[model samples]
Each structure stands twice: as C-alpha cells, then as structure tokens.
Target: MDSGEKRLNELGYKQELRREMTLFKTFAISFSTMTLFTGIIPLYGSSLLYAGPASLVWGWVVVSFFTWFVGLAMAEICSSFPTTGSLYFWAAHLASPKWGPFASWCCAWLETIGLIAGMGTQAYAGSQTLQSIILLCTGTNKDGGYFAPKWLFLCMYIGLTIIWAVLNTFALEVIAFIDIISMWWQVAGGLVIIIMLPLVALTTQSASYVFTHFEMSPKATGISSKPYAVILSFLVSQYSLYGYDSAAHLTEETKGADKAGPIAILSSINLGSFFQHSETSYDFSYLYDTSNETAGAFVPAQILYDAFHGRYHNSTGAIILLFVIWGSFFFGGLSVTTSAARVVYALSRDKGIPFSSIWRQLHPKHKVPSNAVWLCAAICIILGLPILKVNVVFTAITSICTIGWVGGYAVPIFARMVMAEQKFNAGPFYLGKASRPICLIAFLWICYTCSVFLLPTFYPISWDNFNYAPVALGVGLGLIMLWWLLDARKWFTGPVRNIDNENGKV
Candidate 1:
C-alpha cells in the first residue's frame, strides 16, 4: 500500500475510494465546482442593480481576501485529516473527545446540505441558461422571447440534475478526465469572453466607471441603504468562491492527498477569484451600455448578444459563446454531484443520515457511489420544486446556498480555534504560527456574511420578494436537532472507524 493508503488505515478508513486522482485532476475537481459561468452569470444583474460595477470588482476583492483566509484554515486541517468526510472529520479529530461527536455532527449536516444545495443552485441556473439559449436561437429577445413557465423550468432543472447524476456514476477515471477538461474549458472560455467583449463591443465604459461606480436605486431593488445593498452584492462573490471544499471531500481518491488536497483547496480559490474578477470587470464595462431590460433577463447572455449583434448584426457569435458557458455549467454540475456523492458515502459509513446502508454501498463494477449520486439528484429535484410555485424562489434558493456553505465552512474553522488550539496535529501543509490568525479572521467573516444574507434583500418585503433563506435553514436545522434529541444522540458518533487499527493513530 502507498503512503496515502497507509494514512487512511491509520485514520480508521479502509481506503475504499480509488486513489487515482493526480494533483492536477484533484485541483480540477475543485476548479470545476466553482466554475465562473455557473456562479456569476445567474446573479450578474442583481449584483449590478445593487451596487453596479464597483461591487462586482471591489467587492470581489474583499470577499476573495477573506475567503482565502478561510481556504488557508481549511487547507491546514485538510492536510492533517485527508478523508472523504473532510470538514466533519477534521472537527471530530481536532475537538475534545467529549464534544467531538457533537461538533462533527453539526459540521456534517451543514456541509452535506450545503453541498447538495450547491448542486441544486447550479442545475437550476443551467436550466435557465438553456431556456435563454433556446429563445436566442428562435430569434427572440428578452422582451419577445419564449419565456418558460415555472413548471417547465422545474422540468428543465430535473432533467439537468438527472444527467449529472448519470454522468457521475461512470468510472472513476472518466470523472477525473472530465474534470481536467472542465478546468481548461473554464480557464480558456473565460479568457475568451474577457478579451472578445472589448473587441466586439460597440462601446465600453472607462476603467473609472467599471471600478468606482456605485448605485442603489430604491425603486429598482426596493432598498435605499447603500451599505446594505453593497453587502447584498457580495453574494455574487461569495457564491462564486465556494465549492473549493470539494477538494477536501475528494481527498480519499487523491494521490499525495496530504499535500495535494490542501494545494487544491487553496489554488482553486486563488484561480477562481482571479478569473471571476477579470471576466466580470470586462462584462460589466460593456453591460452598462446595453439595454436595461435585456440585461435584466440574463446579464451575461444579453451582454454577449448585444456585443456581437452591434458589430455583426447577427447573434450567431453570441449563441456560440453561450454554448461554451453552458458546457461549463454541465461539467460543473457533474463535479459537484461527484463531490456530494463522496460526502454522502462518508456520512453514511458512520450512520450519520437515514438509509446509511444503501447510500454507503458502491457499484460493484464502477466502484462509484451510484446510490448516493441518485440520492443527491433526488434531493436537488425536491429543492427545485418550490420554483414551480414562485419565481422569487430562485432568490431564496441562492440565499440558502450561500448561508449553508458559509455557515458550514465556519463551524470547523471555529472549532479548530476554540477546541484544538494545542491539540491539533500538523500535516504536510501546516500554516504554523499563521493558522490561528487566519482561522479567527475566517470565522469572523463567515459570521458577518451569514447574518447579512439573512436580512431582507428587498425594502418593502412582501411574500413575492421575501428572502426565505432564514426560514429554510431554520427548519432544516430544527429537524436535524429534533432527530438528535429523539434518537441520533444515542448512537450517532462522528467518523466511525471502519478498519481495525489497533496500532494506528489519527
């Protein structure tokens, strides 16, 4: 057995996942999960409407800096405990034995829910992108295009979710190969859009406008508070910078994971932030000149259409570019599903969730978590069901996605500071003296962003514009707590040791 497998045995896991992923492919998994196209495009208009180009540019910088602190803290812990359970496992291993189980359980539910909801958010956005593509092809603009009903959009979301689940059930090598391709696709495609937008645009805004502009139209977004609106705009950046934790969740399947896993987590954040900044900096420069109505329908798509149309009087170029973004979403969802399945498998191995036996089972031939893949798909479909009744559900879903992920990330980091200050072990990627400071800052930022997203986005909040993230998260946690009080506390200890490691150490 290799050193990674040896480490797994020491940690009480059986090395069930194939450790075939290389450094590059491991990075690719996280890279794809935070795809710029998947995260930024859906919320571009809302961000613009909130604080204009400055928020997209400067707000991204602020969010990226703090997110890097979070990533660094996570990387340190990930190196010490390179398991598929990731954050929860790290919390359990690092916390005091008396409180370890409870800490682990809390992180597990938060991270697992965040991951599955991450997939739901991506697939839902992909469905809308597909709808935009069809309308563009049929000679329809946002004003006269074929608008899909809520039910139809939900159907589209379901179709995309199923496709991602099916793809994830393939062989391990196939998934790794697809992830490498996805990384390149996002990098290359993003650069193309950044460079091509200026080349084809009828006119572009100056750097001052792109970097210094700020606006908060009370009439447009129903908020008059500039600071609050700017904070709300940070969602675009926070959402785009997430999903890098997929690296930690996939470490069991990664070679040299003690080092590579941490690198993947850190590098994905750096690279994703760079690309988002560059692309949005350019897209917004041109977007302000485009019609407001067109930009409102879908900012990125309409920007591409207007750019190419102004130069060539045809949207063929825009349509082709849209396909590139759609491809990014397709690959991003697949990677997310892969990561979610691994989380499910790890959680079930310890009886953390209902139906542990089934979810923990892997396919005989492919050795993939086929059951878990479908379970994630099913849950995502259920989450998307609310989209059928109201369009504002999209706002709520995105809010929950941000809150779930940010809160999940903060728990383990906070635990490391308060519970494992001296007890925590360092691995290949230790931060040494810098670890505590980084963890403290990360935790603080997470607390701020979580609370900010819960506040109402619209000023005069009615049922239509209500931000339901707080409600959804409250109910989900309440149910989990209810289960704990009734039954889980009796038996659910965190990170069950599957292997007989009499001489092994964690």
Candidate 2:
C-alpha cells in the first residue's frame, strides 16, 4: 500500500499534467477573445457617473494608467514562474511551508471563488447584451422593464452553464480550438463595431452634435450624481476593466508560460485602452444614451439599422459581435472553471479540501480535470441564481470577485518579494537584478488599487449609501482566512516537500 506522502505525490503529479498548456494555442485563444469580449465600449465608461460622458471618458484614461501598472507587476511575477498553479504555486514555493500552505490557500480561495463569481457576471452581461440586440432587432418593447424576466434569465443562465460544463469536460486541445476560432471572429467583430459606429454616426449626424450634444443617463444613486463626478466616473470605468485580470489567470496555460501570459494580459489591456479612448472620444455618447441608445435599448438597433446595415437590420454585425463576445466570455469563463478546479485540485493534493476525490478526478481520455470543470460550473450556477433579487446582486458578486482576485495579486507579489530578499530559487524567469524595482512598483500598485477598491460601488457615498459590495468582499476574504486557520494548515505544506522527480511522482 502507498504511504501518505506517496499518495500526495501522486495527486501533485496530476496537477502538473493539467499545467502542460499549448503555448501558441494559448496566445491565439486569449488574444482574440479577451480583446473582443472585454473591449465592450458601452459598459466601460457609460456605466460611470452618468455624471457625463466626458467624465467617464477621462476616468477610463486614468484607470488605464493604473491598470497598466498592475499588469506590469503581474507580468514580472508570471515570467518568473509560469506554473499552472498560478499565484498558489508562487506562495507555496517562495514561503516557508507552515505559513506558505495557508498563504497559498488564500490565493486559491480568492481565485476559485472570485472566478466563479466573475463568470456569473460575464454570463449575465453577455446574456443581457444579446437580449438588447434581439429586442432592438425585433423592435420589441415591454413597458418599464430594465431587463428580461427572472425566469427567462435564469433558464438561459442554466443552459449556458451546462454548455460550458460540457465543453470544458473534453480537454485542453478541444477547448483551445473553440477559443481560437472564436477569438478571430471576436477581433473582427470588435474592430468593425469600433470603426463602423463612429463613421456611421458622423455621416448621420454632425460631428459637433455627436460629440458635444451627448447627454448623461446616470442610474439613480439616490444622491446628486453630479457633484461626485470623479467617483462615479471611476465606478463606470471599473465596470469595463473589471475582469481583464483573467489574462493573469491564464498565465499557467500560455507558452513561455510565465512571460507571455502577463505580457498578453497587459497588451490586451493596452489595446482595450486605446480603443476605449478613440471610440469614446469620437463616437456619439447620445447614441449610447437615452433616445438614441446604442446596444442597450431597441431604439439603438433602429438607429444602427438606419445608419449602418439597414436591410439586415444590423443583425449580422450585432449577432457576430454577440457571438464573438459571448464566445470570448465563454472561453474566459471556462478558464475560470479550469483555474478554480485546479485550485481545488491543488489544495486537495495538499489535503486542503473536502470531497477531494471528486473535484480532483482526471480524465484518462482527455488528461484534464473533468471533475473540477463540472464541479466549478455547478457551484457557479448555484451562485448565479441570486441575480434575481436586485441590481446589487451582480455588482456585489463582481465586487467580491475583484477584491478576492486582486487580493490574489497583492499577497503573492508581497510574498514573492520577501522570498527573493531571503534568496529563494528565483526560477527560470526571475527578474534577478530587476527584482527590487519591479517588486516595489508591484507593491505600490497593489496597495493603491486595494485602496481605490474600497470606494462605494454606487458612488456619491452617504449613510444611505448602503453599498454591500465592499461588505461582501470583506466577508468573503474573512471566510477564506477562517478556513485556513480551521483546516488547511494540518495536512498540506509547500508543494509536497522534498519532491523526488527521478522515478516520477505517480
């Protein structure tokens, strides 16, 4: 019979197998899709202050700078150690085992939970966007409702989750194929929209009217949305840039795994930033707002139809964008599942979880963790149901995801810095001479974002502000801390210490 340590080694080997991602395929899949889905212009800044389109536009510019810093920090870290374990691996190897196990657990907890929640929002956003396009195409109107019915949304969410679960169950190569094809479609669709929207607007309306006469349509915050313009604008921009962190999450799967992953992430954001600035500055904000709405309401569909592709009613453009973005989102969402499952699987190898047997299952056929995919999907579906309650459900979930995931950023960077100071391995991609400056800037960016991350989601803060997003985030992290103290420390310790590779682990 195998001893305890031998069994742990066996499980750890399986986790490594999952990390063997195809580099070229990884880049093609990530670049094409993340760029399209995340390039969503409407949600990025318009969701901002409602204070004015200009403010949201500026906020995006400002956020892009800070976002670049965060990306740079992540790039350096991923390059140093491009393991599938992500930050969890960094935590385990870089710190002493006793503390390292718990620290890495925190990273995994944030990643697993955050990705699940983030995916839920992605599903929600993609669905609503599609819903908007459909309504616009058909010119359908249901008086006074901001969204589709609860039942319909729930059913659709479940359907998509199942589809995602099935796709993820196959294996990496299959998933990569789907993502690559969709990524190209996504890139073409996004550029077309970016170019077409402005040209169409200019030909239809005077440039002055398109840029100057655009109006604000802020969702009610029960306070004057005007005075706190910057805060509101920041919130709006936050919506657009919220999940680009997924690029870092995919680091383990990329070729030159460590370096390319972070570079791709930062690069994608840079492209996204450029597009947002160009598109927002020139495109008619009014076309994005009331009366001349773009993708949100049916009127925009009519305007687009009247403007760009009337005969097809812009359906080809709209549907193509939707399909590309949805496909992007699905791949990103699937990455979340795979990452989450691995976290669970990794923690299990270290004896950090319950039901380790199921979540840790690997497919003999596909060589992927089929169990982790479905398990994470099942959890996401359960979590997604809360959206029926109020608008806050989505915000709160997203906010919590951000805090957890970004916290993933902050903790690992700090831990890596301290380890380097103590003379750790420094791995294949280590910065060496570059470590101090990179680590310091990383430390600074992480601290700054974590602070900015505290501002109320609804903005225009007050006693009645009652924003629960920050609350949800705090509770989520606290629970993770609590879990570590309660259990993780007992069995797991630093990447199955004294790993003997000569004979192969399993």
Per-candidate TM-scores read: 0.94, 0.80
Backbone clash pairs for candidate 2 read 23-255, 48-236
Residues 397-475 of candidate 1 have per-residue lDDT tens digits of 7777777777888878988888645677678888888888889999999998888878887768788778888899999
The parts of candidate 2 lying over 4 Å away from their true place are 1-20, 32-35, 44-49, 96-98, 142-147, 202-219, 222-228, 236-270, 277-324, 420-422, 427-434, 451-454, 459-466, 501-506
Q: lDDT of each prediction vs. the true structure?
A: 0.81, 0.57
Write model 2 residue lDDT over 1-506, tens digit each, in one string. Answer: 21212332432433245444455456554454343444345443234324544555566777777776566656666665555556676676566655777777777776677667766766665565556655545543423323456677777777777787788788777777776675566566667766776665434434454334424444453334455545654654554554444544454444445455665666666666765522323333434444433433322343344454544434456544455555666666655555566566555555555787776667888777778777777877887786566544555555666666666776677776676454554333455666666766766755655555565644456544445667766776777677667765665564553254566644
Clashes of 2: 2
How well does candidate 2 score on lDDT at residue 464? 43
Position 15, candidate 1: lDDT: 83
Clashing pairs in 1: none
* Per-candidate clashes, comma-separated: 0, 2
